[model samples]
Target chain A: MTPEILSPAFGLVFDPYVLWVVAGSALFGLFVGAIPGLSATMATALLVPATFFMPPIPAIASMVTATAMAIFAGDIPSCLLRMPGTPASAAYTDEAYALTKKGQGELSLGAGLVFSVIGGLFGTFILILCAPLLAEFALRFSSFEYFWLTLLGLSCAVFIASGDKLKGVISLLIGLLVATVGLDNPAGHPRFTFGLPELMGGAELIPIMVGMFAVSEVMRSSISVAAPLETAQTAIGNVFRGMWGLLKKYPLQTLRGSVLGTLVGALPGAGADIAAWMSYAMSKKFSKEPEKFGTGHIEGIVESGAANNSALAGAWIPAMVFGIPGDSITAIVIGVLYMKNLNPGPTLFVNNAASVYAVFLLFILANLLMLPFGWAAIKSFKQVLRLPRKALLPCILVFCILGAFAINNSVVGIAMMLAFGILAWLMEENGIPVAPAILGMVLGTLLEEHFITSMIKSDGNPLAFFDRPIAGTLAATMIALIVIPTLARLLVRKRPA
Target chain B: MKIGDTVLGALFALLGAIVLWHVRTFPVIPGQKFGAALFPGVIAAGLVVCGILLSVRGLRQADGGGRTIAFDEWARDPVVVVRFLSVPAGLLFYILTSNFLGFHIAASVAMLGWLLVFGVRLLPAVALAICFPALMHLAFYKLLRVPLPWGLLEKVVFPS
Candidate 1:
């Protein structure tokens, strides 16, 4: 929080080398984002080791810039090729693709780009004004409260289940089981390592993430090769033509998407994909032409794309204020912070307030910088579709392999990535939702640790969870989330047909 | 879908049983009633409940002649399965050969092989296979000062 910290960050940003690093990272992010299998989390994870040698401001700037660009670039492929560049774009892929088919591809791309920047800027403003207050509130949480928080995060699996609730819960349980591997907490006993030293620390996040998102996606892409790649025949037209119309027509949708995206981003385990879906669903319900949604709606593209990008900024809030990660990408960012010997949590703001503020400033700057870069990127990415898949897939595979290998330089990690890739493929083939499983793996350890510690502190008091007001509220919220949906369904069924 | 759900549900039930049984081995401290296994055990119970629900739902759907699972669609797409399986297969080969082949050689080979399997062409594949690892090596080893496995190649290239 000292002026010294802020001064160093400001000076660093002005440094020629730091600016180059930020720009390079953003460009790299745009490249990866344009590719269907590559994602923001994977790109961030791949770049994390490279930042080990950088100064704090440069390192943070690179990550923030990359994340923002990656999210924005995701819309490129979704708009042009019907392939979601990132999972966040998955919610709007149908709508965006439909628009492209209708020769309104330029408008869809423009809407995605402009709203993404707007959402990113809005989230940054919120971070600047609200993070400190949230941090202060988070400081009140003790072990008991943390237990509820972790449970609350785990309960996100319910919301993740789009149609089949039971399947989602099952997937979550599998993720929790995977997390139970390695050394046991509290007692320091080994649980499921099976005497393998590589697993002593449990399944690393990087490999699992690479496998679930990148590898599984590649597998899915390999299928339907006959789906014939269609180059958008539409003109690139004026990028800003219909902006006034959209803003005037769907102001409420944009505001709702931005706010909901930010809130979801603040929650641990809930990332941009969830944010986009939630916004899309909300926008659909609020739409005057709700039935015309799936056909090709500009509001769908704006709301979902904006929500996803804003969620990126929202993610940094919890990560910077609390040591806990708000999502997988932030988890990787936390790793980079640890590598730099900068601890994240309440004390981070107190000890390094200026640098943190600089980081907030960088988020806004990065989003603003995205305008020109994203415009150029959209045009370039359309060209990328012309390249033979025969050539592009291999290059992507190389990057994926190296990216996996670079983390820890352990062969075991690479092998783990491949193994999980196969498992992910099988799961997808079987119709299992991979998102909840990944969320489970991410939250599993935290949930277990908190549950054990809270029990120990209470000396066997199960009611200790309800004893604390915050804990009780969180627990109640989790229960309500589960019950409300079932109740609604029942009420609908009971209604006259 | 019915068969798949039944199998999955049974698998979850088995997992729950295993967790519940395993927790018995850990000595529960006197004051602390719950042991290290308690939390996992609770999650396991939840899994069992969910699994049961899935199995029941799947069976009911099947009995009602609901939407059937498409086994033919999955069978038709063998490349998807291969591409998926090849990642782990390639990684295993990389890990097994990294020491003898050296990090750079092993990684380059792995990358090349993965590209071929993924249907990438020869020239760009070869170029990327070499450049990506070389760049990573320079960044991690030379710039960041993190030591990567040099293996037998390092002694010949940069003998101390």
Candidate 2:
């Protein structure tokens, strides 16, 4: 609130160079996210090398702007082609596509854009208000707390994933297994590496992600490659139209989604994808008409879309505060923070208050800019779908190849992508959800590291896990979530009907 | 595959057992009782229990017919099979030949093959195959400064 904090950031943030960086990165993100097989994370991954040349504030702004725009642009393909442009959009792809098929494409696309801006702004406000206090609180977190947090995120995967819970659990285990494939861990001993020197570093997450989402999608699209992608509506008239009415109708859902998305997103391991999935599930669970979810209901999309964008802002809270990434994107951002000499942690607030505030300002700017840029991207990209997916698929394949290779500048990355692509295809073919596996892959290392560190610190005392109050509360929540469901089923069976 | 729950459950249970057995060979740190294998072991245990539960439930369910692998209607079509195989083949082609053929040449060949097998006509396929790689070379090599393999073109571009 002080002018001193604002003064230095005002000059840095408003510099034309920074603004241009933000704008250019935003466009890059939009294009990448609009493509069917590409994702926001891939956009961030590609930007890392380029970021080496830029200053800290611009580097940070590029990420904040691009990710927000990409998240919004992801909705474009999801609605038009039933192909989610990013994994964050996957949670509501069917709903958006169904609405498009029903000739309500404008409403779906509009709601995604407007609610995204609202939810993003809401999360930014929360980040501005709560980050300092939350960062103070996060300083007290130990490996025990983080272990429970990772478990909670893992549970969110099961709770939110569609279809059978058992299948979801299996998919998660597969991801966790993949996480175990490298040499580095708490033990510093390689397991399941199968002697490939490249495997020593562990499964490269980008390739795995690109493989799971992009490559598997390509394999599935193969079934209908010849069939032209058709849409019930052609012109996207007044995308901003009806968004206000829908927002008014579901004000609570919007607030609920934004709040939940931010909270889940602020958690150390859970990211925007989990936030969207959990919000979508919670929206259905609490809706007046719960059964309306999957068969193309905008109700779920509205809530989840808002949730995912808010989650983006929420993620930076922990990254800025604790240097522990709230998600994968922030994980990369943290490295950039250190490289830029803006080290994260409590002292960072005192040492570099202006740079920190500049980051906050950039978040607000990025969300606001999404309104115009998102509209333009949506309008133009709709026309480009005239090209058959047969041609489009090859372009995506090349992007995937380049994206996977660009991550490590190695062909091993490409091989990993193709191998995982096949594995993910088989898993999906067996009715297993891919999202939980993705979550597992991301969290698996953190989970192991926390668990081992906590156990060693406690000298193998299992009781120590519940001794700490915050850890105890999280553990209690975890136990109740598992136990209460079985207890409710038992109680219902015994009662009588 | 629309695998029967019992079969899927058995598969998972077997996977769990294999992991559990594998953990026995993992080297535990001397001072710590738990190590890298402990987490995987716990997950394996959960997988086994869940797998058993799923299998039992599947066995109890009535009318378990047609619960095995069942291909979609599109799977019967030859074109679909070729289209499906084309993507993986393109990836494999790149992996095996990218260094020898270079990124541009390999990607063009892969892109062209994918476009054709997926039903794009030869003319458009040829156009995209050639144009796309050039665009990629500009962006990745020139813009980003990534040293994509030049292969045969290496001698002409950077003479030894």
Native contacts recovered, each model: 0.48, 0.73
* Candidate 1 lDDT, A1-497, residue by residue in tens: 45767677677576888789888998988987887767887678667556756887888889899989998898888887788888889999989989989989888989999999989998888888888887788888887777776666666644643346677677778888888877766666677676778787877777677666666666666554324466565457767788878878878888889999998887766789889998999889988889999999898888877799889888888778765567778877876787677778777777777777878878987999899999888767757666566445544554556556666667777777877877777776666766667767766887778877787788768899899888889889888977887799899999976
User: How far in Å is the alpha carbon of A428 misplaced in model 1?
Assistant: 3.4
Per-model i-RMS = 3.5, 1.8
The 10-residue segment of model 2 chain A with minimum total lDDT is A155-164
lDDT of 1 by residue, B47-158 (tens): 8788777667666764543224445454556776666456566667777888788878887887787777667778977897898789877866787765667787988889
**Model 2 interface CAPRI class:** medium
Write down the DockQ of candidate 2.
0.63
Residue B97 Cα positional deviation in candidate 2, in Å, after optimal superposition = 2.1
DockQ of each: 0.46, 0.63
The positional error of residue A171 in candidate 2, measured at the CA in angstroms, is 2.1
Per-candidate count of clashing residue pairs (backbone under 3 Å): 4, 0
Off by over 4 Å in 2: A1-18, A28-67, A70-112, A160-163, A230-257, A260-308, A311-359, B65-67
TM-score of chain A of 2: 0.78
Cα lDDT tens digits for candidate 2, B1-160? 4677887788889988998999888888787787777877888887888888878877876887324656778778888888898889899999999998889889999999998898788998999999998998898888877778887777878887
